[model samples]
Target: MAEQGKAAEGRIRIGIGGWTFPPWRGRFYPAGLAQAKELAYAAGQLTAIEINGTYYGSQKPESFQRWHDETPDGFVFTLKGPRFTTNRRVLAEAGPSIERFVTGGITRLGAKLGPINWQFMPTKSFEPEDFAAFLSLLPRDCDGITLRHAVEVRHPSFACPEFVALARRHGVAVITAGDSPYPQIADPTAPFAYLRIMGTTEMAGGYDAAAIARWAARARDLAEGRVPEDLACAGVPQPPGPPRDVFLFVIGGFKEANPAAARALIAACA
Candidate 1:
């Protein structure tokens, strides 16, 4: 399916953070042969997709199939485990539900599945001892398949060095994220790297080509060879402004920054 993906020079993956549209069936869009063609059209520019919506609930197989068929090959799909499993506040004890959610998400996507993002909420105080132990229990096999795993921790404790050590030990990627409230994840060394960029960040979220260029410059530096070793921990930063082709994930949220980011990415990549 990726065979049809238009190859653009200075290409960089650009996409929205998660599904926000209510309608799924092919009503809003035409190009997408599946549920949401508009989303698909947006996804066309992105080489990878981080499905944050799935983290909230389970998606039907039909929905998953539709998404898989609409996209081209070489496209990476990063899914977030349900919040019940990921959010360690009241739902931390919900182990059975967690397993079910993870299994369902992974199985539904099948080959399209990439890393399952386990993003923790900011409420829970970071407790590495319990947290790390719980994370260790994640089955290496999901629905009889082994997949890449990445964790995005919101608690401050996650920023410490110990968290990095634990993430590296496991085959999970240490997500690099830039946010407005606080910068949670960092650029660490691992087999895989998960990155998150907020379009609202005062420091990074401006519709300025210079800002996008700066972010792209950083991404190009990190994307250099030796990605496998860094995959576990290494990931490029998110390009500023609208979703751009300069970085792996040019996330454009509800902001004018999306197009701005896109412009900057095009310039830097050019």
Candidate 2:
């Protein structure tokens, strides 16, 4: 990892998957808050968000710009790479589709755009050559701005040294999926780290205070480039690398408890 401007203070951001959950209207969100104000409100609470809608379809430039304008400075939105490409049968032939998605209006988000997550299905087993070809299609920059990439491979076959080497070669982060049915990877291959917390309680707040504290410690370790021994990672053990920025998100454990989970994580980290 290269030196970053925010590394000194530990650039760790905690957030939820998305902000438009109707269940949160009266639970996590204010009772009378307008639906349109949800993004703005959520942005004020969390440091970053994972944009899942983009995986379904392309969004307009205007929508991207509006999201940027609504958020506070330094807030970021990590987009899900369109399923059209990832779900295709031949992963190697997804270049054009990848181009269209990359050159789309996503650049309108400018500095607010974070990592692009290319999530593979649980059945998508590790195919070194094919997966490497797909990774080759990812652009380090969109237009003139730099972009980061992460791959969320669910199949257990991905938990191998070869997969780790491929990702490290491409400088793409392998998502650290916390408590999921999917394989958890803590390689920290990219310049930064991206995490998805899949297990949260159905309680009012997503996680209990103890869990929140544990996650906070994990976040601190990530920012400081210290990978915990407990987490699973592919390949042989390696020494701790330099500190880098970290982006953490709570992805659908208890849907309504997401906001509270994010807030609690943020407070614990602070």
Candidate 3:
């Protein structure tokens, strides 16, 4: 494992995926990014975060600067590429938009950023070949920032060995979620695994018992790998080496027990 940063580098790291409570925009987030930092501070025990709201558009400089200033050092942040970067838009339509959004987000995130997720919208006919081509088209230099990249394939056509091969080939981490179809394609060898466990139906309705156990186990394995470093590649040598500190995010649980669930998972993970 790499020499760790400040926060405790567990075998695996954990946090709530996000808090998209609609109320934030009107009250907590009158501006946007600055408010998110404050919200992050309030999440209690979270050491890292993955921001989804930014997927809608690029953030303003002032907003991002607030993020840079407010977050405790060693806070890892993962952000999904904006809609313009990954929607069903034609290549012609997507090209420019991708450039703009990626450039903006990278600049905004700067050093705080970790992974950039490209979550595909599931469609019946989205085959592997076409998807492979799409993956190829992504600019290696997104916003001049070469952060860890990941992709989540929701279409049923993506659940196959070939797709996983393509992901590894492109250095794109295949996201592991509690969602249907996508979960079927989980890759254990990914550089950093991410779990978006939630209550959504697309995630098989609610959390499954076995799925939670899988998450707990993964947390243990990854935390063991961290060894107290922010980035986990210091002396990691080669394949089948210790797992990097993955993010096992509880995106959902019973609404009432959300906090309790996070704590329980954290304890089990410890």
Model 2 bad stretches (over 4 Å) = 1-9
lDDT of 1 by residue, 1-270 (tens): 131112422234444455445432232234345444555664565456677778777888677777777776655577778877766554336568667866664566666666677777776666766766666767677667776667766656566666666676775666666433544554444444455666533234344555565655555544442222222232343232221122245453434344335434544554
Winner by lDDT between candidate 3 and candidate 1: 3
Q: Write the per-residue lDDT of candidate 2 for residues 54-89, one digit (tens) a residue.
A: 999998888999999999888989999999989977
Ranking by TM-score: 2, 1, 3
Worst 10 residues of 3 by lDDT: 227-236
- Residue range with the least summed lDDT across 10 consecutive positions in model 2: 1-10
Cα TM-score per model: 0.72, 0.96, 0.71
181 Cα displacement, candidate 3 (Å): 6.5
Candidate 3: residue 166 Cα off by (Å): 0.5
Residue 270's lDDT in candidate 3: 54
| Candidate 1 Cα errors over 4 Å, as ranges | 1-12, 19-35, 90-94, 200-206, 225-253, 256-270
CA lDDT of each candidate? 0.55, 0.87, 0.57
Model 3, 117: alpha-carbon shift in Å? Answer: 1.3
TM-score of 1: 0.72
- Tens digits of per-residue lDDT, candidate 3, 1-270, equal 111222544335455555555533533334555544555543445555667777877787676666656666555677777766677644334566666666663566566676777776765334566666666666766556665778865666665666667676777776665633344444544566665656422233134455555556656555445222221221223334454657656664453334335545655555
